[model samples]
Target: MYSWQNNEYEADGVTPKLSEAKRGPADPRLTQSNEDQLNVLLGAVVNYDKVIGDHTFNILAGVNRETIRNDNFSAFRRFFISNDIDYMFAGGDAEKDNGGAAWERARLNYFGRANYNYKGKYIAELLWRVDGSYMFPKDTRYGFFPGAMLGWVVSEEDFWKDNVPFVNYFKIRASYGQMGNDNVYYNDELQEYQYFSTYGFGTYIINDAMVKSLMESRVPNKFITWEVANNYNLGFDFQFMDGKFNAEIDLFKNSRESILWQRNASIPQSTGMSLPAENIGKVDNSGFDVSLGYRETFGELGFNVAINGGYAKNKIIFWDEAPGAPEWQKSTGRAINAGLYYNYAGVFRDQAEIDANTIDYSDITGNLRPGDMKYEDYDGDGKITPNDRVRRDMNNVPTFQGGINFGFNYKNFDLAILFQGATGAEQRVGTDESGAIGNFLLDFYENRWTLDNPSSEYPRITDRSDQYYSNNNTYWLRSSNYLRLKNVELGYNFSTTWLEKTGISSARIFLSGQNLLTWSKNKVLDPESSNALGHYYPQARIINSGIMVSF
Candidate 1:
């Protein structure tokens, strides 16, 4: 259970009439909210294992159900003689807008799986599940998903032992499955308006009398159902040198279809009516992940090291749109974070060069002058119009990310460290996006072009030319590659013989540090997070020393 309360004062200075949007202490407002939820669950499981000849069978079945609910409310008041008395009962005016909401949800599922193997060389497994959610109408509330996997252990075969003594084991497996997402919103849970029509009161004046009229605020679609994801994965595992070295790798692909997106934004305005949500979008995401490790002993010291990395890329394959946009205006078939902007050539230094340039100044900046951004005539038409700009999609985010970790041990002492980073990423910079003026980095003005400097890299600092510094372009894109010392730790274990009289069973001391160092060309923010607006707090450096003991 949790409870919340809010109290605030708003000075009246800028509004013609005071209301909920611009409330004053005459509103002597006090708001409170209390919320609690209870979930009850029941489940049953049965398992069976049998061995017949050279084959083994393992099976399992289960059924589960759960229920949950939440409720909340808040109220406001106005025209209080004393600000100390803030409750609704102590006020002279009733709040025009005070309400609350409550929602209940339940889910049920039945699932089963079976596995079988022959001589521990060949393996196969199958699974099936039936799930139901109250988010949908009763007529089409249930969904069925199934999955299967198969594997082969090549090292189990005798032929490998005689042919490759150094190789210990090798196995390969693949799986395919489908899943359902009951969450209707891409970022929020299902809401009452998503399931049915929603209504609100509209104020109107008729015959010199004020009246309240009921109006539909949201359209409804009863046929909406599930957004589904179909996935496939293939993986392999192997070991060498009697388990001294080992590695496992997997590749996966998934397609999420029938995604829920409110189509009202794309509907044609001529229709004169607003629309609702529908299953009209799709996305395809695929990536691979792998890991490797090694362990060895030298004299009394031991070495265990591992390095692993992976990458993922996604694109919007399908979406709903109006028919009249330019072909380049549509960003489908590109990475979701892709962008388009004008192309930057260089900065103009003197008026003579600006007058001699082939670009038609009137086409872009009617009052063109020196020290403004020089834009390329990508279309080669001698006119730098909107059509001259091009579309691009890359370097928005790193498609590859990975890390290297290793550790060493000698008797009672041990040490470990990790180096991690990402590549193939890019970001845009400038006061317009990340921030501006007082928020500029210390080095922002260091190399900027000036009358005495006339540098080609940066334009003169001026607010007059929006076309130069305010526009986005390739010039703003910066590489986001970085190498960071992620974590390091050193520890030593106390020997039992040295602590014979201490009465403690075990004890150890350790020191650890995180985000100790970073190397990169990115100056705006942490490269990994792409913090442009300075909204993100830079990663913190953490160090600690602790002792552990058990009795």
Candidate 2:
């Protein structure tokens, strides 16, 4: 496969006829960018099947190789001779910028599978694969994976049919598998061929003149290899009441080993060299997913309802810990991306309580005052320090998520509605206490701590420029749980008589909406945003109507 893309942007600053003297130059600009990508795949396969007596067998094998190449170039310029001419050649030579990059990736795999069945009631399968990648050293570039599965179809058995005719179909299956991953990055940039050292050239001032210097840009780690995941799953599916009701449930556990991560804890920054990532991390995740659905028809009306949900939680099994680090500050055994924060202990109500307190917080909040936020000293020390921070599970990664789908068809009219929600996530609220950005929210202003209110839920207002009350603590964390109307649609299809009269095979019209409504306790910002500080743009709501016809 091959693909290419091109983009161009041209702009000429506009100046009001009466305000030309008040405004500076127009600064016309133009930018052009293009990308080229190429992908190639080669594969061969063979299959064999045989039936002997009451037994059946199937075997298959294949080899695959894939490669990809991608390149991009961009150029920009400003200061055009005339705004009327929007070509790049019309712009001055100054402030010219251009950049280009190219990269290639490849992978190869050999796989095979075998299957056996007895009398169409029992089933078994075996699978194996060898994957190779260019990201690792030659000795560790390849990984071997194997998997197997067993299933029992209860509905196919004579005894099951005789005992429970109402329960139309049922099947139970279990499987285990392993896979490898070589996708890793350093400093937010993809690291390809991480086992080899790399260098780059840069200009430096020398002897009052610019000189080009060559320097090492990356250090290699030959021991770095692929990260592997061992996965186990058991699941079952069933239908009853002549297929009107159905459900599926699956339990899964995955253990990931040799995760690619940099050793920032064990290695010191004073080493004066950038170190390559190593495969030394491990984590375990276990979860369950379930789905239930029902459908029935009454005369000319048919309707269906389905609901599905899943829950997953992961814990770090192994991670590099800074020597002498407190147990409360360790990342191991905690959920991935957990944060460290000062534990909120409520706000001081009066000056007497601040004077009675012995814990020193001068290093953190400068000075204590009435209505100021308070924190707990996790280490039991008299002074509050960074060591007092404790790991917290409050983050944007939701542990539970699900959706509800409902639809119905009545004669020529159909309607569908979907609702989605998530829980077990949190985001901190941002506020401008000094009204620099605008007036404070009425909810915060009415409930703020003051001499008259003395509310413990909120602290007293302060200048936005002051960092006095700015601290990462549970007080700022708010549950990100929310339920939203994801989508709804209504459509009407013309009858056959009407379509035939119009000389058309089919015709329909539909009205649909997306992200129409949301309910959440975090009223300040959208709960679905992943930023710890809710600063991203909220999801857009849309309503559309369209007609369709086929002739």
Top candidate when judged by lDDT against the true structure: 2
Model 2 spans > 4 angstroms off: 1-40, 47-57, 67-104, 117-120, 200-210, 215-219, 298-301, 349-353, 369-371, 409-415, 431-454, 461-468, 489-513, 533-537, 540-551
- Point out the worst 10-residue segment of candidate 1 by lDDT: 1-10
1-551: candidate 2 lDDT, tens digit per residue: 22222232224424222211334445768998999999999999999999999999999999999999999999888888888888777878888877888888999999999999998779999999999998888899999999999999989989999999999989999999998999987678887777887777788999999788999876889988889999999999999999999999999999999999888787777888777788989999999999999999999999999999999999999977798789888889989888878888888888888898888997876778888888888898888888988988645688899999999999999999999999988776655443445466565567678998785557886544365555466776779899999999999999979789879999899999999999999876788987644458879999999999999
Q: What TM-score would every model get versus the actual structure?
A: 0.84, 0.81
User: Per-residue CA lDDT of candidate 1, range 211-271, in tens?
Assistant: 8899876667787777788999999998999999999999999899988777754677677
Which residue pairs in candidate 1 collide? 395-426, 434-532
**What lDDT score belongs to each candidate, Candidate 1 first?**
0.78, 0.85
Where's the lowest-lDDT run of ten residues in candidate 2? 1-10
Off by over 4 Å in 1: 1-27, 33-46, 51-54, 66-71, 94-96, 186-197, 264-266, 326-329, 357-369, 380-391, 430-438, 461-468, 501-511, 543-551
lDDT of 2 at 320: 78
